[model samples]
Target: MKIFIIGITGRVGSLLARSLQDRGDTVSGLVRRPDQQSALQDAGIVAAVGDLTALTPEGLAELTGDVDALVFTAGAGGGTAEQTTAIDFGGVVTAIAAADLRGIRRFGLVSAFPEAWRERHLGAGFEHYMDMKKHADQALTHSDLDWIILRPAVLLDEAGTGRIALGPAELHGDVPRQDVADTMAELLHEPQITRQILELNHGGTPVAEAVQAAVRR
Candidate 1:
C-alpha cells in the first residue's frame, strides 16, 4: 500500500511512517521547509515540501502522488493562538478537501480524548486547542472518506508495551507513542477495521489484538 502522512516528522508520525515502511508500504509526507527533506530522503521516504497553511486543496491533492491513504498528526505545538487554529483545525479542513479533490477515500486522524477540557483547563489556549481537535475530528467523521479517529489519552514518550485498550472504554492512563503508532498503522493498512472513533489507552490487550477486536465490534 502507498500512504501519505501529514506531520510525518513528529514522534507518533515518524513511528507510523517507519512501521508502514517496514511492512513494505510506500510512505510520503509534506514538509514545510527544504531543509527537512534530507531526513525523509535518508529514510527512503518521499518528501513533498510545502506549508499546509498555504496549500489549496487542489495543490495539496497534487502532492498526494497517487497514494492510497492520508494520516494527519500535525498539531499547533504551542504556537500562537492563530497558528493553533490554522494548523490544528485548518490543516484538517485542507486535508479533507485535498482528499476529496484527489478521490482518496481513506483517512486517519490523531486526536485527543474528549474529556480533555473537563479533565483540566490550562487556560484559554488549551481550550482553543481542544476545540480545534474536536472540530477537526468531527469534520473528518462527517466527510465522505472512510475514516478512523484515534483519540488517545496523555501521550507518553516511554517505550511501547505493544498493548492497548482501543475502543469506547472509559479513558484512563497514558499511552506510549509507539503503541498508538502501531495501532494506527494496522488500521490504515487493513480494510476490515471499518470506520469509527476509538479511544486509546494503555491496557492488557495486545495492539494487534485490540484492532482485531475493534473489527469484531
Candidate 2:
C-alpha cells in the first residue's frame, strides 16, 4: 500500500513510518525542510516537501496523490497557538477534503484520549490542544471515508511490549509511543475496523489481537 503520513517527524509518526516501510509499503511524508527530505529519503521514504499549515486543500491533495492510505500523527507541541490550530484542526480539515477530492477513503488519525486532559488542570496550551483534537476526530467521523481514530493515553517514550489495551474504554494510563505506532500499523491492515474511535494503553494483549478484539466487539 502507498501510505502518506502527515507528521512523519514526530515520535509515533517516525515509528509508524519505519513500520510501514519495513512491511514493504510505499511510504511518503510531508516534509518542511531539505534536511528532513534528505533524511527520510535515506530511510527509504518518499519525502514530499511542503507545509500542510501553509497549503490549501488542493495543494495538499496534490502532495498526497496516488497514495492508498493517509495517516495523521501530527501534534501542536512547541508551536504557537495559531500553528497548533493549523497543524491539529486545520490539518484534518485539509486532509479530509484532499482525500475526498482524490477518491482516497482510508484514513487513520492519532488522537489524544478525551478524558486524558479534560479532568485535569492542564494549562492553556494543553486545553487548546485537546479542543483541536476533539474537532479533528469529529471531522473524520463526519467525513465519507473509512477512518479509524486511535486515542492513545499519555504517550510514553519507553520501549514497546508489543501489547496494548485497545478498544472503546475509559481514557486512563500511559502507552508507549512504539505500541501506539505498532497498533496503528496493525490497524492499516484491518480495513474492516472502519469509522471507530479506539482507546489505547499498555496491556497484555498483543497489538494484532487487540485490534482484532476491537473488530469483534
Which candidate number maximizes lDDT? 2
Per-candidate TM equals 0.96, 0.96
Itemize residue pairs with steric clashes in candidate 1. Answer: none
In candidate 2 the C-alpha lDDT for residue 199 amounts to: 94
**What are the per-residue Cα lDDT tens digits for candidate 1 across 158-210?**
99999899886646668999988998998887787667888999999998788
| Regions of candidate 1 where Cα sits further than 4 Å from its true position | none
**Models, CA RMSD each:** 1.2, 1.3
lDDT of 2 by residue, 1-217 (tens): 9999999998999999988887888899888898999999998888888988888888989998798899999877757779889989998999899988888889999999877856678789888888899999999999999999999998899999998899888548889999999999999999789999999988899998888989955
Give residue 56's error in model 1 in angstroms: 0.6
